[model samples]
Each structure stands twice: as C-alpha cells, then as structure tokens.
Target chain A: MWDGRLLRVDAREQAMINEEHRPEIGESFPVHAYYSDNQKVRIHSRIHYHSYYELVLVCHGNCDLMVHYELNAMVAGDMAVLPDKSIHSSFCPPGEDTQVLVVQFMPDFVYNGTLDTVDSRYMAAFFNSLRMKRHALFQTGEDLAMLQDLIWKLLREYQEKRMGYTVYLRAYIGMIIAYLIRRLFRNEEELINYLRDYHRIEEAVSFIEKNHREAITLAMAANQANLTYNYFSTIFHKITGHTFTEYLNLIRVREFERIMLGGGNSVSEAATAAGFDNISNFNRVYRNLRKSSPTQVIQGLRVAKS
Target chain B: MWDGRLLRVDAREQAMINEEHRPEIGESFPVHAYYSDNQKVRIHSRIHYHSYYELVLVCHGNCDLMVHYELNAMVAGDMAVLPDKSIHSSFCPPGEDTQVLVVQFMPDFVYNGTLDTVDSRYMAAFFNSLRMKRHALFQTGEDLAMLQDLIWKLLREYQEKRMGYTVYLRAYIGMIIAYLIRRLFRNEEELINYLRDYHRIEEAVSFIEKNHREAITLAMAANQANLTYNYFSTIFHKITGHTFTEYLNLIRVREFERIMLGGGNSVSEAATAAGFDNISNFNRVYRNLRKSSPTQVIQGLRVAKS
Candidate 1:
C-alpha cells in the first residue's frame, strides 16, 4: 500500500522525521516543463520573484494563471509579462497539454542599471504591452515567425547544443522582446503614455533594486519617484502592495534565497550578499515572513533530497 | 588630434540605415560591436566577435545603448551576450568612471552538452567548483561574486524565462550553462569523461547534441565515424568521444549556429536540420575543413568602428 507521501520515523527522538523541501530556485533555473505523449505538464510550483523580469509564451493549451489572485485563462499563442515581485502561479486545465516557454530575468539581463534609472525603452514597451487586458501576444506576422523561430532555436540549442549556445540564446530572447514591442507600439499615443508611465515605475523599481543593499529610506525612494513622501508612500504600497521598506526587504530575501539554494555559501554569506546590513534583523524578518529560520530551511532541503 | 578610427562601418551597404539591417527569414540577429566617447572629446570605440562566445557586463560608466547600434552605452553592469553571426556596434566606452564586465564565450558554451549529461565526470567537477582560465576576467571579488551569482541563477532559468528579462538583455547566458551541469553531474567517472573528451573534436561534439530534427542523416553521420552504417553509430561515437547523434548537432550546426546569428529556419535550420542528413555533401564538412560558409557570413563587419 503506497501513497504519495512517505514518512520516516526517528526512534531516539520519538518523533516523525520531518522532511525538508528546498524549493528549486526559480530565479536560478526557472524554466520547468515536462512533455509526454505530445503534452507539456508543469506543476503549479512555488511562487517567487527576481531582480530580472519574466516573459511567458503559451504555445498550446488552456490554463488559469493566478497573478496575485487575478485569475486569467491563458491559451495558445498568448504571452504574459510578470514584473518584479508580482506573486503568481499557473495551473493547466485537466487533460490539457500545455506547452509554455517562460523567459525570466532581471534588469542586469538587459543593462546593469541601478533601480533609480533604467532607460531601456525596449524593456518598458515589453512590460507595457502586457498591460493590455487581451491582445495578441505576437502582433505582427513577422513577430509570430520570429517567436516560433526562437522557440525552435531554443529547442534545437537545448537538443544539439554547441559551444556558446547561451550567448545566442540570450540574443534570441532579446530579439523576441524587441519584436514584441515593435509590433505592438508603432507611434501610437497609448504607446507614448505607456512608455512614460513605465519609465516612472522603472525609475522607482531601479531605486529599490540598487539601494536595497543599504538602509534605503522611504523618503529616498519617494524622491527617486519625484513625489512627496506621503503621496509616493501611499501609492507605492498600492502599486507594489508592500511598503517601500517591506518591498525592498522582500526583494533582498528573494535574491538571498536564489543564491542560498545553490548551496555555495553559508547562511550568513547569503544574508550579507543579499544586502542585509544586520544579521539579527535579517533573521528576524526571515522568520516572520518565511515562518522558519534560514538554516532550518536549508537543512530541511538537504535532508529531503537525501 | 586623436583620430584612431572613432567609428567603423561593417554594413554591407554604407547607405543602408540601421532599421534596414533586419534579418532575412530564419536568420538570428547579426553580430557587431562599437565604441565612442562623450562631449566629442576623444575616445576609441570598437565591437566584434572573438572566440566562440562573447560576454559584456557593465562595471562602471554611463551611456545610452540604442535599440540598433545607434547612440549610447548605458552604465556599468549592462551586459549582453553575442553569439557568432550577430552584428552589434557600440557608440564608445564609458567615461573615466566606467567599469565593464566582458567575457568571450568559447565554442564550449553550447557544443559539449556538458551541462546536459550530468552523469559525466568533468562536468561534475567543473560545476562543483567552477573556475575560469583567466582570473582577471573575473575582475573584483565583488564583481566575481555578483557575476557568478548572476551566472548560475541565469543558467537555472534558461529553460524557462516566464518574464521577458531573458528575451532582450540575454544576460546570464554563461552562468546558466555552467550551473546546470554543475548541479546535476554526480558520478566521478562520468565527470572525468566529460573533461577529457567532451570539449574537443567533431564526432564527440556532434554526439553531444544529436537529436535536432528528423531530417538529420543517421547513416551518413555513422559513416563519418567509420562505423558500420547501423552499429550503434551514436553509442560508438560516445565510447570514443563521449557523444551521440543527439549530441553531434551541437558540434556541427544544428545547436551551435541555430541560435548564434539567428539560425532559425534560415541557413542553420537547413544546415543542422538538413545538413546532418548528408555529412559529406553538406557545407558543414567544407566549413569544418576550410573555416568558411555554409551560410553567408555576417556581412559588413569592418575591422574598425568608424
């Protein structure tokens, strides 16, 4: 009689041995899809975020993607953009063979700009294009072709990979994003406004990403946004759903988790590298938010894998 | 008084504008680089390809990086990956306060499937403790720290970028490949095999990325290795070179060129998807022997950026 769950008993401690699950670091290796019998299966998996952004191409099937509780049904040829820190998950309809190519990254992937000022308009257009309630993921016929080419190129690379495939893979990624923007925003007024707003938010986001290392104050972030502290603070919470400080810390935690999961450094190193000036403070926050200590989490993952 | 080739034009037609450089059907982005300076002072600017792969990271400095090699080079840590066949031209190097991150990817970037077959020994050791031949390329410890973190996280996500970050910037192209293999390979014997034979030669390379398209010629490739047309051509190649047919495409053209300068359905698709079917007859053999074209060379790359 075998059920999915398995438990080990520890006699000495007289307790059931707890299992540790080191969630796969999505930021480290985010693309996860299984294709069987012509169907692609991807578990809902854990929710997460990163310094870089993400773009998803739904090649086939139907599913509901829960981005902060806004459930949207996704089908073939649809694409979506998940901005930084937007909690999200995706689930395919029963028996639906879903195949999705997910591209996730951060500002560094494009340019190494601080969060205060990232002027890559191509990226802005990409983020803005997703703002549309419903739009063709590939606007131009050429764009669709380019996207298909990229997927095939990726598959081929993954299949028969040569040296430096990564270099070209990144280039394909850039081409897809550039094509998406060009196809959707051709000298339109909405495009202009989209760029403007995107820049504003981008500047704010950059501020958070770069300054998250130091003791970034609300006033500093507000100033970067060119708004009064009160106005910016209230609006920031609304848009990002966390106070500026909270948002900054969350960003750090996400990054910290990414590095730590690779099992390269000690917990303290992860904390320090992720921009925690105070270990005690970091630990307290980690416990409060994650409901566990960093060590416990790491140890738990190792045990589970064993 | 310092006229050291400030700008170089590699465009096939001097009059051909930037927008006109769009790729033909199935081609990936062209490869080129540029150089420039601010205030019309004086500076040297250049961009080109070397080795098998290329890497760019912003260490320090500021300039705008136009969509098409147009005007500026943004701040430090703004990185880009250029495969062979890509054409990128830069404006100028950053000011005195600039820091840059640049690494040229060798053909190994995608060829060996070192990252794919984790059971191999060399791959295991490399991943367990990743190191570059030149430490200077690593820059400051901080830079290495950030770069490595960025690299591995980027590799982890190469299979899936749900957001658009990987699309445009194509950053983290290097680290993802490195980490993928490092995390998976466990057997010592497999690791040794990877280091010794995986990196060099054609057949070994080919077997690594073997399965690209159904059109590939199994018989011809088998003969190329001097094996009976059907005596486990793939398995024989692996015994000698540690490879397979699914692996051969990586060494030849299917995986290598497909993503490099836009291998889409264009020349590479024909080469990898079609060329493998007739190894002796295809241009890959000629190119392998002569170091020249199965496809048109990325046209218009001048030795100097004007």
Candidate 2:
C-alpha cells in the first residue's frame, strides 16, 4: 500500500509496458485524439520501477522529485529518465501543484527498427555497457528543452499524421536514448566519477532495502558508508542520481510491490507492510508517483496474477 | 496501410482519433497475438459493451493480459469486474494455447448494483438473467463441462470473494459476468431457438452500417442477415462472444492527447483532412460510438470554430 500502490503495483508487479495499455498495439493505422477527463485524478503513481524504461517531462510549474534516488527541485523545463527496473519516484511536493507530461515507454520503442536502421556505433556502445544501461539522469537544461520539443513534435506528428511518423517516433525514441547516453557518458571522467562512489551508494541502497521497515535516514546511510552528511548527499546524487530520502522511498515502493504480490493483498495489509504509517499519504504519493491509485494497483495485481 | 489502419496506431500518434481512421471502432480486446521479429504485441482496452454487456472467464492459460486495462493477467485463475471504460488488453497469451472461461455481463452488472445495494436483489436479478446470457454455442464437451463447474460455485459468491481468491482476474470476471448471469438469466426461449440463413451475413452487416449507420439496429437486422459460403463457414465464430467484429470500426484509438488553451484549431479540418478516407465514419461513429478518435474531438473543437 505504498503511495504508488494504485499505479505502480500493477505495472511494477507485472512488468508490462505502456504499449500494452494502448488500444492500437497491433493496429496498422494510427489515430490521434484528445482526452479530457476531469473526473480522473491528474496525478497518480508512486516511486517504482518496471522492466520498461520511463521518461517524465514537467510541462508546467516546478516539482520536488526523487529520480533514481536523487532529490531534486525540478522546474517546468526539467526532465528525467529512469532505465528498466531502476527504482524511481516523483511528486510536486507538499501543497505544490504542477503539471507533468508523463512519457512511459519500452526500450522497443527505440530499439525497434521502425526508427532508423542505421545503428549509431556510439549508441550501440552505450547500450552495450552495463553502467550506462543501469540508469539515466539528465541535468542539462538544453537537452531537456530539446527533448521537450521533440516530444511535442512527436505528439504533433502522431496527431497530425505525416507520411512516415511511426518511423519517426521510433527514431525519436532512439534519439532521446542516444542523447541521454551522449550526455551521461561523454567522457571517461563522467564514467569514472559515477563509478567511484557507486559501490557505497549501492551499499546504501541494499542497506535501505534490507532495513526499510525500521527508522532510517541520510545520516544512517552516510554512517554506513563512513562519510559526512553533505558529502554523502552530493555523492549519492552524483552516483545514483538520487538523494537518500528518494532512495529510501524507492526501496519502500519496491518492498510494497513485493508484499503485494507475495502477501498483503488488501490495502491496509499492503500499506502497513510497505512501511507507510498513514494510508492517505500512501494513496496520494502512490497517485503522484505511479500515476495511479492504490485501489487500482491492488485490483490490477489481482487481475494480472489471476 | 490496410483499411484497418485506424485500428493499428497507439499512444504515440499525434492526429486526433476521429480523423485518423474510423473503420475499427468497436473491436474488443484479446485480439490474436502474433510476433514480428522479437517485438511482442500488447493491446490495452476498456471493458466490452457492444449492444449488450459481456463476461469472460479464462481458465487454464499461461497468458499475460491486462484486466480492465489496469491489472495484469499473470496466470489461469485471475478474474475481473470491468465497469465501462475500465480497460482490458491481451497479455502474454499462453504458449501452447490454453482454455478460457468467459461470461458476458448484461445490463444487469450495473442495474443489479443500483436496484438497491441490497445483496439479495442483485443476486436474484443476476440469477434470473443468467439463463438468457448462457450461450449454447459452447458446443465442445470440455467447454460444457467446465462451464457447468464454473456455474455452481461461481454463482454462490459472484458478488463477494471466497477466502484467498484473487478478485481482479478473468476467472473471477467470468464468474460474475458469465456464470452468475447465466444462472440468473436462464429462460426457456433462450436455448436452441434461432437458426439464421448464413449465406449473406457480411453483406447484411455492411448494408446495415452503410444505410442505417445513423439508426440503431433492430429486429430488422437479424431478419435479413446472411453470410456467404466462406463467411458462413467462419464468420459466426468471429461474432460469437469472445470476439465481435463490427460492420464499421466504431471507435478511434486516442493515441495522443493535447490541451488547447486558445483558438485557431479546426476539428473537421483536423478530421477528414488529417488523413481518414471515410469522413462520415469518422464523424458519425467517432462522435457517437468511439467518442474521440477525431483530432477535433480530441482538441475539444472550440479552437476550430475560433
């Protein structure tokens, strides 16, 4: 019953991607349409991960986010990408309302040949690497802006219907992934910088996973790594692209998924076991992070596993 | 693209659903799954509501299907209760094929809930309706056997769950919609009464949609319906409960969404002009049936008038 229990529970638990959530999966012709559902909550989800990749763009206002465990004060123009199975969560923070353009997709959206058959050696190399494949966090303002534009363009093409937009979408997905790899792994220093503290960060993550039921904090994680608070916070973000709080929450979401699948099929059972003291917060956070509600997730899990 | 192009696109498209292609409006979920190279096809869709409601039970299938468009289909025993607009889609269909337990919920799934939250009223109404809902077409001996077993226990607790039963599964779904409804709606006139002249069925459906697209089908539909030799040979199965192909695709898949704050967008211009060949299908079917495939429908069309 962690906050993302509604959305993440089903998606995370089943590991199905967005394509499966669409009506046009195998249809030959594409259609564009508008959607407005005032009855539907605008934000639903919790910090979680599925096997498919995720990209989120904030179209309006600012948000306080934890991406791949990094705590970030994100603005309208900011964006982030979480790779397959990487734990991540995001929200507008307390009392702060924001509009987010959520983009959930599978790696096939890029890797599919509908994009460009021309495989860039750089992209091939980047995808081939374990570290680069693990996760991605975009900090560059320009890249974010460009990504936003490309997304807009893709949406426009999808809506407008050009000659070969499907191919374009595949290419755009690839371009975005390629761009992320280029930004993250542009130099040896970047890779080295990310790896040096990765061991400690991972250790911190495992510790959180192993002991999330108890009270834990940045200091605790820092002490486990034998580092100072300020240094550890910076190093944690640098290495894992998330802060300790974000990481802890991701771990909790992961645990929530585990419990939901194994036992604790009910809301109360799953939430408490996931470590959320207040079910409402669990609901709200789950909605914001996973883009679905807990009732939905539990229901989804039951249906999926059934 | 084939005439069924409109049915093919997904969330990545930009054009409005109404304008793209309207040939495939009322196609139900659980379409045949096939692989192209390595990419798997997945379809997410809402609950089925043709002229009537339906219920389906999936028994021994190792497939992955999304229930009501949110839950996952992980194994054999899952069941689901899908309200209209609640989505569903094909999951990993079992490898060597599998058995299914399907039920169609009638108008009763809703009315039963309303007549009073009174459990007895719902039960009585559900049981009474089951006779009419039970299909005699499940001619296979094994299907009849499984259907009988499902009918007994499933009816006892269609509204409530047994201990440790997963609520959001297809089996559960079949229980509520198929078996319970069958037991309730059972009527003498319902079994083995009608045999149609199958020689002209497709032509009949085509004539109905093209001429009476503006009007709803009545007893007139069954009176003159016929099927060609080839169609009569296989068409009945397609129109059977598990799958229902329409005379005209009734809805447009909303592949993309856009929010317009200002004027200057054209709905009709966005529709037929966008790329759809059958403008009338886009207009009548999209608005009345699919509700939102046209670009203008998606943009809210106020911009178009402006």
Candidate 3:
C-alpha cells in the first residue's frame, strides 16, 4: 500500500516489498502489487519483458521509464502503462527519493475468459501503446490523484486479502482501466477503430475457446476473424504474448485441469478429452505449460479438497 | 448529444428532445436519454418521481435541482444523481439559459439480475443520497470533465443507435457510476460501510430471486438478511423505493413475463408458476405492476417473433 508509513522504512527494508511474485500458471487470480522507493536502495534497472501488463505510478520525485526502447522522463503524478511483452526498464536519480507503486496482472485478469468487447476496450490503452510506440501515460492533475487513490486501495486490498478481496480488486482494476482509457484516448475515432480491431481478435479467441475440444488450427481461427493467417498470427502474439499453438495448448491444459478437478475421470481420459492426441505428448505439453506434472496437480487438488 | 447544435434550436424544439421516454415494464433495454435547454423553452419544474434512476449533467449556465425537497444550486459542469422514486424538480433562472443532459435507467440496467456486491456498490451513491438527505453532486474539475465527455459519448451513442449501442451505453453508464461512487465517498471507511449495507440488501434480493416461485414473505427475507423485520422493511423500502410486497410482486411479474416469452406456456400457467395461486389476484397484480394485460404482452411478443 502507498501509505505514509512507508516513508520511515530503513534502507535495508527498501527492497522487501519490491520482491515480485510472478503469477503461477493457471493461477485463478493473477494480480501482484509492489512498492519501491529507489532513493533508499538501488532499483531494478535491467531491461526485461513479462507475459503480463504492468501499471506503474510515480508517487514522488522523478524517474525515466523506457518502453520499447523509448525513454520518457516521468515526474510525480505520472503513470506508465506497459503492455504485455513490451521490453521496459526504469531509472531513478541518486538523490530524488523516487517512490512508485507497480501492479502486474495477466490479460485473463481483464478478459476473465470472455470475449466481450467492453472487456477488450479495457485493454485498449495497453495494446494501443504498441502501435503508437509511446506508452500510455496519464499526467493530468485530478484524474491522476483519483487513479493514485484507486491504486492505493487496490494495494491495500491485495495485502490484506480480506474476504471477497478479489472482488474489490477486480472492481478497482476495472475503474483504473476505464480512467486510463478515457484519459489516454482523447480522439473518439481512434478509440472506435481500436475497439473494432480488438473485437475482431476477441472473435478469434472466442472461436478457440469454443473449439478447443476439436482439431483447430490458426487458419480456422483466422478465418473466423476474417483475417489472413499471418496477420492474425502476428497480432495474436503481440496482443496475447503467445503463439497460436502455445495459446491453444495452454487452453487445452486449463481444460484438462478443469476436467480432472471435476472428478470421475482418469488423467489420460481427461487429457484426451481436452484434445490431446497421446499420453506422452500431453505430458510434455502439460509440464512445459504448467511447470508441474499431471500427477502433482491431481495430488494438489485432492489435498485441497480434503 | 451535448454538442453545440442544441444551442441553435428554437424554443418549440427544446422540449422536443426533453420529451421523456419512460421504460415499459418489460422493456428489454430500459435506458432513456434527453437534452434540455431552459433558455429555449420552459424547463420541467413540476415535482415528479419515477421508477428509474436519473442522472443530470449541467453543460452550460446554472440551475437549481431539488431532490427530496432539498434544493441545490448547480452550476455548469455539475452533476446530479437522483435515486428512484426520489421527488425531484429543477429550476432555471429566467435568463440563465441553463443547458443540461439527463439519462434515466432502471435498476436492471445496473444490477442486470445479479447479486454481485460490486454492482450494488455502483448504486451506493444513489442509495446513500437518501440517508444523507443531499443528492450526489460532483464538483471536481478534471473528474467532472471526464464525466462530461462520457455523457456526451453516451448521448451520441443513444441517439445514433448504431450496432452494439447498448453495449457502449452500458459501459459508459458503468464508468459514470464508478466515478460518482469514488468521488462521493472519499472516506474509505464510509465506502466500506455503505457497501456492507448494500450487500446485505442484495443478499435479501438474491434470496427473493431464488425463491420467487415459492410463497415467500418479508419476514423470510429479513431472516435471510439477519435483520429485524421492521428494520429490514424500512431499509429495503428506502433503498429500493418499493415496499417488500410490491418488489416481490414486480419480481414475479418479471418472471411470468420471462416464462410467457419463452413460449409454450399459458398466462395462467405462468402466473401460477411464478407463485400467484389465484387467477384474479395474479391478473390484478400483473396489471398494477406492468400497466398492461398479460394477453397483450403475449401478442406483442408473438408479433415481434413473427
């Protein structure tokens, strides 16, 4: 949480809250919160990319944020929205005492497994950042204050993990995204065009979700979206941070997990029912995607049930 | 829309746009849009109440909005959120040339037949207004600007009626409500308390929805909410603007309509299935709530289908 208590923390504790918790594969809710004051300790300056969207708010002092190799100076009340797989890094001056709050959430956190156009619009700013080659930044006065307040509430809810915290987290995230989109896209025509294109991609995703049980291909999904295979593949990877095949496999793995947890099915049966052809191939894909074996997941589910 | 074109319209054309379109009892989408300029014509000053929420945004000049007998002087860029059945009227000085935009929508537009606490929180401001005895008025600078932009887009979308217009309308309405809640309840504890109270009412509503087919009473709902019967009755009426019996009857009428439209059910059968035991009482309540006969609705549905 971005509260006043953080101002008194010692130098040794500066990085304590900055330890990132990367979302695990198939995690139900994949939102992580972090706070850092770089004047007390060295900030992470390495250029890297992740498979989730990151929203950073500069609470105090100044810093430089690099998105897609473009450096932009940011002062207090500035916000940076970095899209998935967009290479980004940050730098803080030695004596500026720069403080920031960072929130990382997977695309699923916004989409929630649905292809609603409004949900796609929530992600418009992030994806638009890629095309514009400039990250979505909000520097307005009152709107920035409201956004900061929402982020603080989000961080507090995340840290406390109270009953129904995830519900509040999602609500706050939706509000933040809505605010960012309205502030970032001042041109109505640009917003409409972006939403139309996103709707097309969502159509393709909806196709995959419905047909994951069958032998589906990128060409089929592209046809559903009325886009060429290559074009669809490029934008799909850019927007989703996954190749078509990888995404399909991930969906199948998720379905397999769902079926296994639903009970009354053996591991192989669930795997085959999820469109995997053979046992060995399913095992390989499952391990590569989930970072865990099928047996281990089943054991974890059983333990949780007990 | 709140564009400049409205400024050029003649006095006779003023009420042309302000003509209210109240939502029919079973209307699929229950949202209406209106634009008014008192300079062009006489404003609707007669005190009135309706069965929907009304949101008013002042675009130019100033006006006085009276809610529940409390008069508030609103300037340009001010907004008023009036809860359902709240007696309200407006007064514009003779030469002030007050221009405003109004949006009216039923609770179903926001709740959409769900018991989600987040959805209830969106209506927190409106419900809280009754207790606070003053309507929700947003006076901040940038936030109000963003809200005006959204209302303009909403009015445009409503007038154009393009493809997926309802989707955009709902999205914009959600954003507006979110902004109002955040701005109105700056105190975090107040927000939490309001949400808790709203959630309790929503739980009672959810119970009614699930058991509407059974003979349920106010005491039953109060028990479900863990509130005293008298307290539950008072708060439920105040928050929902309907007595417990009236709300239950409305729910049943809605269900009966749903069943009749689903095809292959007689009006009597639907009414009985919706928890009305006698045909005469069913007809009376249906007529009182929906303002139309059951056979007329079935005929309309049939004609539309054909």
lDDT of 2 at A263: 61
Q: What TM-score between 0 and 1 does chain B of candidate 3 receive?
A: 0.54
Q: Which has the better lDDT: candidate 1, or candidate 2? A: 1
Q: Model 3, range A204-275, lDDT digits (tens) per residue?
A: 877898899999999999999999989899878755557899888977876786677667469899998999
Which candidate would rank higher by TM-score, 1 or 3? Answer: 3
Q: In model 2, which regions exceed 4 Å deviation? A: A1-20, A24-41, A46-51, A64-72, A86-99, A112-121, A124-136, A142-145, A188-306, B1-306
Model 1's alpha-carbon lDDT is 0.46
Task: Answer with 2 or 3, whichever has the higher DockQ.
Answer: 3
- Segments of candidate 3 deviating more than 4 angstroms: A1-19, A22-36, A45-52, A57-80, A83-306, B1-19, B22-36, B45-52, B57-80, B84-306
Best by DockQ: 1
Estimate the TM-score of every prediction: 0.32, 0.29, 0.44
What is the two-chain DockQ of model 3?
Answer: 0.05
| Proportion of the native interface contacts kept in model 2 | 0.00
Individual DockQ of the candidates? 0.07, 0.01, 0.05
CAPRI-style quality class for the chain A–B interface of candidate 2: incorrect
**Candidate 2: tens digits of C-alpha lDDT, residues B84-192:** 2222344443233444443333343223333322122324333332321222122223444555464434444333433212112222332233333333224323311
Against the correct fold, how does model 1 do in TM-score? 0.32
Reference contacts preserved by each model: 0.14, 0.00, 0.00
lDDT of 2 at A224: 90
